[model samples]
Target chain A: MNFAFTEDQMAFRDAVRTLLEKECPPEVVRARWEGKPTEVWASLSDMGVVGMTAPEDAGGLGMDELDLVLVLEECGRAALPEPIVEHAAVVIPALREGGGKTAQRWLPMLAAGEAVATAGLGEAPLVPDADRAALLLDDHDGCLHAVEMSACELTPLDSIDRGRPLFAAAWYAEKDTKVEADFELAFDRAALGASAQLLGLADRMISMTVEHSKEREQFGRAIGSFQAVQHRLADALLRLEFARPVVYRAAYAVARPGECAPADRSLRVSMAKAYAGDAATDAARAALQIHGAIGYSWEFDLHLFMKRAWSLAAAYGDGSFHRRRVGDWLQQREDSDA
Target chain B: MDLTYSAPEAAFRAEARAWLDANVGPFRDASSNTADGFAKLREWDRLLFDARLSAVSWPEEYGGRGASLWEWLIFEEEYWAAAAPQRNSQNGIFLLAPTLFEFGTNEQRGRILPKMASGEEVWAQGWSEPNAGSDLAGLRSRAERVVEDGRGGWRLFGQKTWCSRGAFCDRLFGLFRSDPTAERHRGLTYLMVDLRAEGVEVRPVQVLDGEEGFAEVFFDGAFVPDQDVIGEPNDGWAVAMATASSERGLTLRSPGRFLATADRLVELWRARGDRSDPAVADSVVRAWMDAQAYQLFTQQAVSVLMAGEDKKMGAEASLNKVWWSELDLSIHEAALGLLGDEAQLDSDWLRGFEFALAGPIYAGTNEIQRNVIAQRLLGLPRG
Candidate 1:
């Protein structure tokens, strides 16, 4: 069957691309390498992008996973230093799916762009102030612990990417503030969110490399004219394309939740994460290679992308971890068949 | 955006299924476990063709029933569901028939379509040359114009490799360089040459499966009349591309085909009493899911085209090609893994393994598909 995007979806994509082009132009992205302005985040929140997947009642856009994925891809393409994935993909969904009144009270604020939210999954040292939100939710002992009025020191990590500022926070749970019945669902949502971000990062890397190859020339021709470079770029492109549907499929599974078999969903998510992780890293490395000396320079903006690629890839679980999960899932299926 | 089939489409699916059961034989029995067991499956294609059920979407003037696109898809799904016999005239019915319909002269269609539907004239391709494989445009197959008895025609002289079923096919469709000086991809002309013509030779190349599915054809001044040309002189490149595109566009291998093989693999695992191993069962389920995904993807593509949308190919096709190719290899690899040391020796499983190895190399390499997405779809500057 035809895989062409529907007219509405295509229009939506163009709208998102145009918005990012105008608001988060390359110069703005470059300027906000260290951290974006509060007003810029506020504007995105006003535009309903931050709460794209949140329920309409919760002041969110209530877009499907596919819609959110489209926006995330544009965000990646522009290399915009915004927490769209953190707010839209993770925090908003985590709060709406029965994170309780504590979550409800803050989700709308997060959706309205009045407040900022960042997920602290797999981040070591569990810094409390890493997130600037009024509330921080963490899963421990099979219960989600929601803390209010966090007061802890936040130290920004010396990140390779000036765009994404990493923070180390000191957290105090205060009390056993258990909130959602299904913490695993939240975890899956977070994984899907991270996977979406990885998809965007990977896509951007390929775009950046393609642009560099066209403009960068050696020996009277663009390096892209050379087959060696072409083959590598082609390989990177293939990896990105292959990983794309997996990410969307995983997001689809997460959105539907119980509609899919657990093992099937888990296997797909693992495959998406594993494949996207590897592809993003590879594409970034290839981008660097194609860019050559210019890519390695600090003055050039390529390293900013390379850093984001590395950080996002390893943010959740790495490729090997997800690969083994996929393998195990396959093993289970084989046994069932036998 | 929707993936569900319409109500009428679903009802048609049920009707087609019932019809298939009443007409065709039962599914291939797993007990027929011999090496050539696939050949023993009943000829369901003939039954369908005889009933005017084959190629349902082709025009009514041809052998097809002139059904809607959705109806044709419904027919395909039901036929596969019933485990119908593989089309013995796939080369003629799928590849050549479509090409003929698109570009053939009125006389050509009237002459070839009926025989192809009835399975009387099997057709094979003769495009690949000895020195030209992937770079098909660089082929040196020469067809010089000649005047014989004051009438003009072409005398073909060349060697073609990878001509599948050429040894037994009734006709061969090929590209020949009509203008030697007209540069690559420009001087070629498409011709439908009789395989039994004088000065034509065929030599079969035995594959790893111990079957001769491919052959090399040599033509030494074999004459083809001007009427035999499918399109304009020295315009074979477009025809070739159309043929190749059709070949790629045809739905990926039917799920029923893989389901049959997967079912066999499951039975083998059971016979060995290794069903207790969860790993083995898991692999079976994964393979089943992959086959299902491919089936769904094909259905989606067909649905979109049936809805009257402009159906350009999708990246998913490439993904499907790569995934199915690897799935074949992986299933065999898993089969070998399950068989353990028994897999090392020559067995039916080993033959299956060898056959699956060629999946990636044929019908355009997966590498080429990747390059296509990178350069074309992704807007990556061509290198």
Candidate 2:
């Protein structure tokens, strides 16, 4: 019956908020648009956020995705340019779930925040943050392979989200290359992780627009006083609020997989991802529209979160892709019932 | 965080589902809007009341099990999934009961609620007037203090329109302007009037569904005792807002009903669907997902409500109202779209579509809800 977060979870979330508020402002986010985010990334890694999900035995915090998802949302709120979601949410889970063989080799280094990994679980062709990744996990032909960035033949792919660099890697499962990982689980984790980030992004954009609408007046009154503008922002807020709990519940389901039914595991993540992605994208549109000419400018900070939303919606299982998965599962469930 | 129910909650849910499964079959006679159907549904209401399932969230003294919000939600999901007859006493149960719990005198609750649960006194709302539809503050209904028939009470004079279930209900609760000199939203009193009172007229009004589901209630010197006042005199607006927030959401249009509609829509699609059109399947799937979103959203709100007093729905009620209303229509629209040419027939989906049409208009129009969200929730300026 208790669907609320633990006090510890709220405390941790607040701690992340304080750290992000201090270290990762819009300037930090802007600087990383065409540059590496080494400063904030190292700060986060030092703060033990990079390896948050790795078990404590591996020299990490050993927090569940329930905790990690909250931290990831903070990262999105700050527009922190790091591939930690790929590393912690996708790759670490894949490594841990695949069991001892892969775990024994990479757990210590990854858990110690010394290595950063970016994953491409076949949802997108490009490996996010692959240019800076200490290791890259790619799913080619349904088999996952791991390789270091220095040894891999990879080309950077331009993304709308400039801070998060995507890459197309030329690699296959050769001897000593394959990592025993469940691709399906990695895919679900990626979508769910992206969903958490999108919630933060959407929330921030709406807050930004509301602030702007208050100050930026037209005809001797704030544009927000107009019902037309007010209603659009309200609709965007509705989308975000409704999508939020679905993401949290999905994180809960993903964090404790065995307890959830098999059908719920993937279906929940897909639903979260689809709802969150749509929320973020819609927020971006309304924010841009309400912010007027300033929002369209390159200098304004809204684009930082806006482009992140636009790009994230197309990556790691887009709304349409995740919805199709949901649709497929629903049809299967219905067929069984019949 | 735990989404799974406790053992007792699960047992409660199972008991409710089994009871509904066994009892709902004989009651699916007609739309509960018609006179014949209303009577039949009242019998069902008595069955539920006798079974202690009429108002699970109400206190045990009021014929309810005094269930937790979680258990109540679980019961609602099962209740609607069984396609049970609509709650014949909803105007009392949903709209007035919460207000009574919060502001009514102990005497008011003790006298009104038990009979309400038993369907012995059906209550209808008297909020809207021809002039005060969206602008409810513009209402001109007047109630003056007086001594009539050796009773110390107020005499009501004015009209209330769009009173749902007024045609058959036994009582009405509404606002009355008590001071002529006061402006709009001022000098009003929340009063409960007996529909059987002298100088009161209730003319049945036909809804778009061709049922006398609503009425135009005219009060020309109708007497209501001081005991019927819900809150302080001239503070009716605040008390009615409590009802608006509580009634327009969690208890009124619960996720259960829409979720059930989604399930039925899916079954219809399976019975006769266009396999080749991915777009059609996408529409159906989106409708289902939206319904799930509402369910999860309600679950989240329930968690907040259980945690603290300050985290009430408030303006979030507007967000919820707009969401479920639109989702209800979308689900029905998808079901009808699947039928194509055959959709025009007088089928359940068509009737549902007609009722769904009123969703955006009732319990405060969706437009008004948007304004509430903008002004109250978002702190936007009012022009």
Please list the residue runs of candidate 2 whose C-alpha ends up more than 4 Å from where it truly belongs after superposition.
Answer: A334-338
- Calculate each model's fnat, 2 decimals: 0.24, 0.76
Q: What TM-score would chain A of each candidate receive against the reference chain A?
A: 0.89, 0.95
Worst 10 residues of 2 chain A by lDDT: A329-338
For candidate 2, lDDT tens digit of each residue in A1-338? 77778888888888888899899888887777767445777777787888888878887798888997888888888877888789999888777766655677887788877888888776557777787778888887787777777778888777788788788887656757677887777888888888989998998998888888888888999999999998999999999988988898889988887788757889999989999999999999999999989899998889899988877878887887888888788777833310
Best by lDDT: 2
lDDT of 1 by residue, A117-191 (tens): 665555352322244555555656666655553554467777656676666655665454556646655555556
Local accuracy by lDDT, each model: 0.68, 0.86
Candidate 2: lDDT of B247? 72
- Which 10 consecutive residues of model 1 chain A have the lowest summed lDDT? A123-132
Native contacts retained by candidate 2: 0.76
Candidates' DockQ values?
Answer: 0.24, 0.79
How many clashes would you count in candidate 1? 23
Q: In candidate 1, what are the lDDT values of residues B54-151, reduced to their tens digit?
A: 66767777778787655765676667656565565666776777678778989999988877776566677888888987778889989999989987
DockQ, candidate no. 1:
0.24
Model 2, span B229-259: residue lDDT tens? 9999889999998899887678898888888
